[model samples]
Target: MRRQVLFVGLICVTFLVNAQEEKTIDLDEVTIQASSIIRKKDRQLIFPSKDQVRRSMDGLDLTRRMSLPRLWVDPNTKSISMANGNVQLRINGVLASSLEVAALSPEDIKRVEYHDNPGLRYGEGVDIVLDYITIKRTSGGNLGVDLSHQLNTFWRADYIYGKYNRGRSEFSLSSFANGHRYKEAWQDRTEIFHTPDGTFQRTQEGISGRDYEMYWTTTANYNYTKDDDYFLNAKLNFYYYDYPHNYSSALLRNSESKMTTDLIDNNKSLNTRPSLDLYYFRKLPRKQSLAVNVVGTYSNTDSRHTYREELESIPLTDIYTKVDGKRYYPLVIGIPCAM
Candidate 1:
């Protein structure tokens, strides 16, 4: 009996050893390599790879490919936003417009400097800054066009950009236009209002008339840069917007004895803005610099609205309003000093 018990104990030990061996695992080593990012105290410098530049269509596309943290890029709107605040885009320390960014060539980009903490030099309310450094171009030119439209809706947008560089100067022109028109819009809603006279309920139904909008902007810019020692830029911009027809008519029924009334509202507006900008920069000794900016702008707006209520095609109430305003700044100058 003792021999039998010892044999059984040995068998159990062998089974346990086999189970432990089956549960054991062997792992392979893994190594992680850093990407093209340089970390600094207050900012980070990023370099785009050859592959990234080759696939990118423009500066905006390259920025999206970089996948910078907390930065959002919308291709449809051609806008960039950051978390908690707005993002400031600059080219070699100079503020850049959307058109300038769109006209940039990925091949000309050298490096990007990102700053999350800005000093007093940037002024107040400056949250983040992205500075794009570009390589010197002896002579070159680029032309591009962007178009977007909805599949089933009457919405369309187009942008055309062209730039030419020679020696130490560059010229660029860009235009953006978009339009929308709604053929048929129907509204069915119930509204309840409490007035001084009494509480009333309104039920509106039927077709809301055609609505249309149009907008366009054009910019012309000239820039001169001589080895970073001297810089000058001049830009002119013109913008126009028109909303000539926004008419809505509906059959409104009131709670008072189920009375029916025809409601119609019409609104239209026109706006125009023209602006000119000039900037100059010079490098001074002892790590100091001189910068000057000048701007002139004018804006005008004209709006008109009409409202009417009719019973059995007879007008019961009619109201109309018109507003016109214009403003202009002949000259505005600013100088910034850095040490």
Candidate 2:
């Protein structure tokens, strides 16, 4: 028995020694980089750093600096767009306008939420949505101005905004304008006619033209808010657009006829629009909320167009048309709440 026990112990010691002789293998180093974007199931949240907020002039400027993926920010229009599509803007779940965006204080922003695919709650045709979550301030104000001009062109965009908050009440006023008034514009196009007869092609070569286009909007806002409770906002907007002159003179040459014609086209349009918006929001228990929005608007418009064509000094075609119209939009109400 002693002999057998000694033999087993020797075998166990040999197995233990082999187990202790296991080798260690070194692995290649891996680097993991963190991104600023936080993706959720249905949305992406972007948190702006202190440096980003400090350098931004206003809410619109902050958004422009974010360089959001697949979204284009246009400073001239104070708008955000995607490829051939529009993105809806909101402030803390409430619909926001350009005036509100201009009046926003960059310091108050907490995070930006982007929804690439909207659910049915947002209604049809609503693909993209941007929601700006903000921290409520009891008192303070903001003033901002944005101006851009092209050195070689006569186009300019101007915006001015002011806001003041006292206690739980806030007031803001903002105005934005974009337009160009110049006589040295250019336009070129190719026209094709497909009929039972042989196809005809006309290519227009423009030398010089005149353009006058302007769009202006101003808004006054009053808001009441209580942190973690409820809020009410009332806004009045006045919008105007004028394109008094858009004249283009070009040489139209027919590829088949081997003929050239002098063509001049002119267009003019004017619009006056006024709108009112009312919004209310209340927070509920169990992380629920209720919101209501109402909007009403009225518009008046005038438009005119004229076309003149001549082979020589004499006119071959002269066409003119004018239209004037007025419209009133009834109150539009929306309620999006969670229980």
Best by lDDT: 1
Give lDDT tens digits, candidate 1, residues 189-260.
798989999998889876646778998889898899998789999989998999999877788898875678
**Candidate 2 wrongly placed segments (more than 4 Å):** 1-39, 148-154, 192-197, 256-259, 283-290, 311-316, 334-336
* Candidate 1 segments exceeding 4 Å error: 1-35, 82-84, 117-126, 148-154, 186-188, 194-200, 312-317
Per-model CA lDDT versus the true structure: 0.78, 0.78
Q: Residue 306 in model 1: shift from native, Å? A: 2.0
CA shift of 336, model 1, Å: 4.4
Candidate 2 lDDT score relative to the true structure: 0.78
In candidate 2 the C-alpha lDDT for residue 153 amounts to: 52
Clash count for each candidate, listed in order shown: 0, 0
lDDT by residue (tens digit), candidate 2, 137-185: 6566666666666665556677778877777887878888888767566
